[model samples]
Target chain A: MNKKINWQYAMMASAFLILALVPLFMSNNYYITILNQMVINMIVVFGLNFITGLAGQMNLGTAGIYALGAYTSALLSRNFGLSPWLTMVAALVVGFLIGRGLGYPSLKMKGVYLSLTTLAFSEIIRILATNLMDITGGTQGIKNIPRFRVLFWNLDTNVKYFYFVWTVAVLLCLLSMRIAHSKWGREFKAVKDNVEAIESLGLDIKKIKIRAFTLAAVYGALGGALYAHFNQFVTSLSFTTDLSISYVIMLMIGGIGNILGNIIGAIVITILPEMLRFLGDYYQITFCTMVLLCAVFLPNGLVSLPGRFRHLVKKKGKGGERFGQ
Target chain B: MEKKRYLSITLAMCLALSALAGCGGGQTPQPSQTQAAGNTKEESQQAGTAGESSNDTAEGASGETILIGVSGSITGAAPINGLRTKQGAQMAADEINEAGGVLGRQIELFVADDGGAQDTAINAANLIISQDVVAQVGPNLSGMALAVEGLLSQAKVPMLTGATSPKLVTTIDNPYLFRIRAADTVQAKLAATYATQNLGCRKLGLFTNSNDYGSGALNVIQEYLDGIGTAYVAEAHNTGDTDMTSQILKLKDAGVDGVIIWTDDAETALAARQFHDLGLDVPIIGSPSISTPQVSGLCQPQWLDNWYCVTDFTASNTSDHVTKFVKDFEAKYNETPELYAATYYGSIYILKDAIERAGTTESDALLKALNETDNLQGVVGKYKPNTMREMVHEGIICKLEDGTAVYLDSITVED
Candidate 1:
């Protein structure tokens, strides 16, 4: 078992090493931008892996959390000339506040109702962002938002921003992995498995749920803050229910409750649409079809491909050879 | 434990890396794939709106095809503008190609659908820039236009816009962004002056969109109104709002004799119809949207009574180029072209003329040629680059009579 755990850690390290190394070879600014986007997405998905993936609660208010985080950071740095580093801390605090504020009331609702409540929350945020032009800049959005500075080195170029965000993403990933593998993670899954048993065991279910939500919110906000600095602009149009749903999709497509799955899912979903652009107008439809197929055929996600392949090989070796590979 | 799981996952990463390489490998004969797909795909329901999304590289061309990029919100909020942008650009490209191509090479336009979303617009801008377009047109929504302006300027590719927001030029000072349509300031000033001077309106009521495009214009209109020492009541509404009775009632209670509205297509029509229904019995002057076919078509003749608007192009104009453009456009697309189509169509020609004059599609040369552009007659009035990069300096103010827009005056400002 100890050897197995060592292998798992080694595997994760190699996957991350590859991600960290790819940007060096990528000379294209567009690809670098896409890479930065993937990093942000992975960070968001890692947080989401806790609440929706592990705890089995639906959260469709991620857009609101992301928007709040983005606006909080963008306004502070652009308007008040605050350091982006400090603004990011503010964003994290904002996320924590939202998680507690939103989580306290809606965590009690089961399934679809929770989704609707969260959805309403996000919609209200978007509407307010759009209607409140004086502060939020309405549809025009806050532009030329300042980049992050690391001890006098500004992350102005996409490459520099790529490394900065990737660093953040990696640290967030390790923290998320630790929590996912910890005792609290087991308890969260236990809640998903049997809430009655959790209640009977004297575990405070609400507290556990809120803790998971708070972690997810913090991670999500951090990701949003990273995005604001990297893009150098923040618009209300970026925050929509479609964005929230895509985060859920990334989590589901990667494999629920898995850190590596979050990374893989974020990378694939983020890069797939760009790769499919040659398909022309059918590209959006084709991308959707591919995702739907992945969901239908590989219910456990792209992370399950190896296990499924091994099972296929074992079955074929044991006289199921008539079935084609 | 599946020990080989690590190997398979690593292989997946390899596949993804290779895919990323393929995506970034721009201008490596990939456009042909798009052309083939666009040809084979079933006809989309939104006909002609597909306008210039993809283009075929014509065989037997003299030199390499000059690629021009066009992008707009085809499938998002305000799709009409995007579709029109594409159609106008497509029509112009087709015309130039038929007229023996520009600079002895066929023009193939690459259009990206921004979906009116900020993230997608940036992606679209980067996609087209990677394809090495000499110039770009559209990205018509003002907020969207502003979002991608920095990207265009960084790439050194000049952008001729269909968006009329004055901030595109004023706020950013981006040298690459050239506003092909008359700025909203022009429209607001004209609307204000016409409502007050021609219509004998005083103590007017104002309606502005609660967006950057409308809100900024509100300040301009207010400044103008204040300069003239005119008293007015103003109200703002969101982009997708259909009912504005509450705001309209406020205007009514203010006892204003005339109304001036600065808004987009649907809202302009909605406000006009509401005014007619509520029996406001006031003369109204609106922004360019009020004159667009999309808005005017939505209204009855009765609703159009006493309504006036300032627009870049009017199908009723007797100008030979304008009429020829309208006739050719309607014949080709089977739809009437309006604000977006006219400006984007004219912008294509303007960029084409610059490309020809520069004798190379090189960014700096083409940009210089665009900057020095003056007195070039196209579909939308005359093209002349100004200090503020405002391309079309003149707007025609038209009055609606019996649901037909009658050209009343042409207001050309040198500034």
Candidate 2:
């Protein structure tokens, strides 16, 4: 078991090392932008995995929180001329407050009802963003958003933005990994598995759920702020329910409770469509078919593939035991 | 144990099959590439095959190819428009290649579908740009265009799009981006000009969808109306709203002489039907979508009588260039082309012209050539890049007569 754990750690380290050297291998601005986008998406999905995968809460309001963060940061940076870094902090606070406020009331409900409330929350945000023309720029959207700058070094180029985004993504991944192994992570799992038992064990279940939601919101807000600055534009159209669904799908495909799974899911989902672009009209169809196949075949997600393969190999080796069974 | 092995094999088979399918999809463009090569061979034969073969071999040795990227929603909510744009672009590319290509090198088009979503568009832009395209053509929707504008600008790849948002050319102000279609403000002003000056309507009414596209047009029309000191009543309806009775009734009560409807094809049709059913007989002027076949097919044929629209293209135009484009497009695509197809077709020709004039695919050179574009005739109108990089300035007003949009007058904004 110790050897296996070390091997897994080694694999993770190598994977990250390769990711860090990606820019060196592929210096094209376009690929770097895609990588940057994928990293930003991973950050948001990491936060989402905490709520949906660990706490077992069906939070579908991620896009709403993301939009809130993006708009807040964009408005601040555009109007008050705040630094992108400062705007990210402001967005996180706003997201945390909104997430806690919404989570507290909705946590009392379960399953579909909770999902519906969150969906409504997202829809409300979208509608407000569309209707509030003066504040949100209506449909024209907020443009010319300032990029992240540190005294002469502007994070304007794709390569520079890639480093900035990946650094944040790696730090957040570490934070999420810590949370997943901590006592709070266990409490989250307990709430997901058996809420009544968790409550009986003298734990504040509502508080645990709210904390999970708040953390998810903070990550989402951070991701959104990074995205707004990186893209240098924000439109309400970017924050639709379709995006929220994509995040949920990524979390599911990656394996809900696994941090590594989230990273894998983000990479595959973000890059697959791009790779399939040569398919012309059949691009979306092929992407959807592949995703469906993954869902149907890998019930526990892609993370379980190696274990399943190993189980198969072991079973094949034990011929006499198979005959006896 | 047998079950585990079986499941493992099944999963492996699925992965392998998907991998094959992905590769198959990636190779879909290879057939087109070969066709382009075959065309070049024929052209070489016409230009003295002996001498051409030597030049071709020399060129092949150098392995020079100029790639231009085309991005649009080829398979999503607005697939028809996207496909039309793609078809137009592809036709332009084929023609350019047949004419011995651009700058003594074949033009290779890298087309990608954006699926009409912001995220997908970004990916499409990234994918095309990764292939090292000299410039890009589309991502037809306004929202998708806005999303990828920054990426293209950063990469220093000039793009010409048919997306009609005024902000696409003005507010964002990406130096590398140019718009082929008239902006929404231009269309709105045209509608305003036609309704007030031609129809002689004093009190105008506005019926706008509450979404970005509709509201954006509404704001622009209001601005134009305000500049002319015209009084008007305005009401907005949300998307997925089938009922416009309340809004129509409000406009009727306001005693407006004409109603300017700003919405998509289906919604515009619905609003016009509702207005007719409500016995409001005012002259109806709408955005370009109101002139589409989809709208005409949806609304009562009689309801469309005398309805006017401000559009960038109408097949009824008698200009030799427009006639030629209509003839060629119909012969090629086996269907009458719409605004998007015409505008995108024009965009490619404009790009080809720019590339030819610049004499190189360098970004700065192409941008300069594009900025200096003057009186370049297209199916739509005379092309010229203004200070804002808006290539098309004039809009055509078309009237619906017996389910067909008839070109009535051309409206041009003074420089």
Best by lDDT: 1
Candidate 2, residue A153: how far the Cα is off, in Å: 4.8
User: Each model's TM-score, in the order given?
Assistant: 0.89, 0.88
Clashes of each: 0, 0
Q: List-wise, what DockQ does each model earn? A: 0.44, 0.22
Which tens-of-lDDT digit does each residue in B1-415 have in candidate 1?
4657667557656765665566556422254344334331311222222233333322211135677788866666566777777778777877887798788877766777777888778888887776667788868877778888998899888888877776677668988998888887887787787887788877999898887778877888899889999899999888779999999998998899999888877888888889888888888888887777777888898998988888888888877888889898888767888878888888889988998898877778888999989789977778888888888888899998877677777889655
In the predicted model 2, the residue pairs found to clash are: none
Question: Residue B76: error of model 2 in Å?
Answer: 3.5
Error of 1 at A285 (Å): 3.7
lDDT of 1: 0.80
**Candidate 2 Cα outliers beyond 4 Å, as residue runs:** A1-8, A149-153, A320-325, B1-65, B103-105, B227-229, B239-242, B276-279, B294-303
Candidate 2, A191-267: lDDT as tens digits: 89998898788999889999999999999988888888888778787888888888998898887888878877887
Instruction: Please give, for residues A1-325, the per-residue lDDT of candidate 1 as tens digits.
Output: 6654554565567667766777788666767778889999999999988898899889998998999999999999999999998999999999999888877865569899999988898888888898787788777778879998889798888888888888888888888878888988988898789999999999998889888889889988988888888777777778889999999889888887778788879988887766765555576678788889999998888887867898988987876666654
